[model samples]
Target: MYISLNEILKNSIFKSVTILAGEAGLNRKVKRISVFDCPCNKDILNRNTLINGDLFITCLEQFQDNKDGIYDYINALIMTKSSGLLIVTDDCIDTITKDIIKICDESDFPLILIKEDVPYAVIMDTVNQYIAIENLNAINTLKLDKIMYGSVSNNEKMEILYSINPNIGQYLRTIYVDGGFDSAIEELKTHILYLNSRDDIFVRSNNYYIFILSADDIKYLKHHSDATALKVKEFINNPKVGYSRIYSRKDISKALEEGKRSLETAKTMNMSFQEYNPLSVMQLLVSVKDTQEAHDFYEAYVNAIRDNVSAENLKEILLTMEIYVANSGDYKATGKIMNQHENTIRYRVNKVKGALNMETDNIKFNETIAIAVKLRILMNEIFY
Candidate 1:
């Protein structure tokens, strides 16, 4: 990101200087700075060396007697696409005329005034230092972005990961947020700063703001009874949040997919946040990249139930099973979702198990049934 002229003025070296005009141009980017000496022979208007985005700084000593020349100089700087102008004023050229200020305001061209005592070298150094920092930040952000999207080569990715966090452990977890772009960025930055995890990188991908944090750090934040974590949760104004399971560095692509899947699930379920569950049949279904394979898997799992049960009963059973799996097989919670007594839920579950002819004690049987139920739901979402 480019550093705006407003930020340069906030620097300690330039803080004492006054912004005389062009408040609207404060956001103009300063890419380079140059000292414009009043060249006697060179045509200042036609043959000026200043480029489009350069910040032109000058003493304006030559224009002391020829005030009209100042107007011409300002016009030339504007025509050259100079980012802004900084003029030194004192006994030599103490004041900018009303006409020059008027032209600057009309053009929305930044015109800053510095006291003559403040050496031009100081201003140049400060602006250059800021530009350098901004450039470095931009480079780092691009590297991190490439890593997030799995675009970096293995060697380069490892180097960037090491540079970002030398102690990067065995696992990484991604937190993806959707909505409240600018506010969420600010709040998340505050939260990360408070946690003292400045090494973590935040990047915008598509419509989501993806935050990459160490798995251990996220675990601490989620489980530890820290006020900072609580404050972070309160401050994050996002409408939907998704978190991926811990994964090795080599599985970053899978981790990103899991994060996106979790986000989609959160949106579908109208949830504030959702974490990817490795055991979730929905997650498994989403993991299958080929649509045909996913469809075939769905058919293999659901064919038995569809053949054995009536259409209406299958719908009821599927709903019951979905609630059962969602509630972690808790009969009481599933009953609440079905708006029935615990005994009723048990009866329906037993009936469904009998119809499917599957042993509840068999882990594979239960997993297949869960997948079948989820697949049916997903199909309904598609066809309906």
Candidate 2:
């Protein structure tokens, strides 16, 4: 993204500069800065030299006595759609002619006057640095966006993954936060930068922010994650936090899936945070989709429950199983937590069992229902 010309004027470095003409074009976006020092004779070269949104700055020393040369330069700038022109004036290049400024006004182009005392280096550095930072932010966020949406090429995707951490076979983990206001989200990003020793791959995807940390980055962070949670609590009364299981970047899609499931699991269990277990029975069911049979097994269960019931009952079954699994299959504990009676909780469990024709031991029942509930929760959290 390009920063506007008006923003540059407010950068404090351009305090002495005067807007002699072309004030109407202050909102023009600038992507780069160039010097308009090329000989006025190279009309063809100058026209082709500048890219769109490039702002040119010069003293016009070579064209000091050539009125025609000055006019040619301005015409070239206008033709190339330059952001603006900054002319440094002194005794040698005392003034810009009325004709030049008049032409600029007609085109709604910006004409800035920098005092001779200011060096060209100052203007170039400030504007280029600002543009570079904005471009970097674009690249950083866009790469993650492509991966999240599954649109990136394999080579480009590997470049992004390996860029975060180059060590071989090391597991990368993603820490995700769900749902925060705009201000709170920005605050969370700034807080993370302040808290971490070095920058990690931080990106805002949709309404949530994700920090994909290297294994090394997570070393002291497991401890600091508590501190991180406190920062979250400041914005969210009871934040839902989820971090993915250790996985290679090759399995990032699965990692993202489980990270989302982790938070949904947290919300369902009435917990503040959840670290998804790769060994989770539900994880196995989700993973089964990677192969035809596991795919069939997982969907067979999820579709059976989701399709047979009304939306209201499906909602109830999910909550009931979530509570049932969370309480370790203890009916009384689940009831007490839900503020419902033990018989009521049992009836809900039986209602789900009836949906699936489940006839099994308690351990089997716990694992199966746990998988079903998580798959549903994950289904809700999936985003493009």
Clashes of each: 0, 2
lDDT of 1: 0.67
Instruction: Give a tens-digit lDDT track for model 2, residues 254-316.
Output: 666667777656665567778888666644444433455544545676567777677767666
lDDT of 2 at 271: 70
Native-structure RMSD, model 1:
8.2
Best model per lDDT: 2
Output the lDDT of residue 338, model 1.
Answer: 80
lDDT of 2: 0.68
Q: Write down the worst ten-residue block by lDDT for model 2.
A: 375-384
Pairs in clash, predicted candidate 1: none
Please report, in order, the local distance difference test score of every candidate based on alpha carbons: 0.67, 0.68
TM-score of 2: 0.51
Question: Per-candidate TM vs. native?
Answer: 0.53, 0.51
Q: What ranges in model 2 sit over 4 Å off?
A: 45-47, 89-94, 151-159, 164-199, 202-211, 217-219, 222-251, 254-384
RMSD in Å for all candidates:
8.2, 8.8
